[model samples]
Target: MKEPSPRRLPTGVAAAAGVLLIIPVLALLIVPLYAKKGPQLWGFPFFYWYQFLWVFLASGFTYSAYVLIERARRGERR
Candidate 1:
């Protein structure tokens, strides 16, 4: 009987995953620290908008990273 090859993570994929995990955590942790008085950028207070903006930024980065990782895995299989 032919044995199936063992699964393993490529270094690049592992590094990408590590970056994806860290960014959001850092964003969350750092946002609150700047939750104080500040000038508005476009009529919105910096304190409020800063945190709000990062929510989208973080989501975008996470989603993009996930897609790239999926693509990489698919390519690896071929």
Candidate 2:
């Protein structure tokens, strides 16, 4: 029988990935930050459009973080 080995992250890479992953969570978590009505984008209120936009931003950030962490993990194994 064999046990799976442990994995480690490079210095600062984990924190960077964590920060990237948290961006969307923090953005939506803060209500007052985007809870507003003003400046419209193609008839869309700032509040409405801002949150909608974060959808893409969140995905991008998530994917980026995933790539970063995965890359570091691959490097750690070598």
Candidate 3:
């Protein structure tokens, strides 16, 4: 397989860059939402469990994005 070519122009580079730029922002969006105090969830309190659940939820999203990106890259190779 051939190495993917780099974008020649700033516009193309910027467009490619733009997609990745939103990822950090998306990852951070859940942080504040979990920072509230509230009642317990199951045995743990909302503050504790909410952050704990975010770990699994964020893992799911990260895995999904990786799989999708892999699929698209493989498709391009064929």
Query: Candidate 1's residue-wise lDDT over 1-68, tens digit each?
Result: 86775556688887887798788778678866667767777777878787888889888888888887
Candidate lDDT values, in order: 0.79, 0.91, 0.61
Candidate structures ordered by TM-score, highest first:
2, 1, 3
- For residues 1-78, could you state the per-residue lDDT of candidate 2 as single tens digits? 757877777769989999999999999999899888888899999899999999999999999999999998888777
Q: What TM-score, to 2 decimals, does candidate 2 have?
A: 0.86
Alpha-carbon deviation at 67 in model 2, angstroms: 0.6
What global local distance difference test value does model 2 have? 0.91
- lDDT minimum window of 10 residues, candidate 1: 1-10
Model 1 ranges off by over 4 Å: 1-7, 31-33
| Model 2 spans with C-alpha error above 4 angstroms | 1-3
User: Which model scores highest in lDDT?
Assistant: 2
Report lDDT (Cα) of residue 3, candidate 1.
Answer: 75
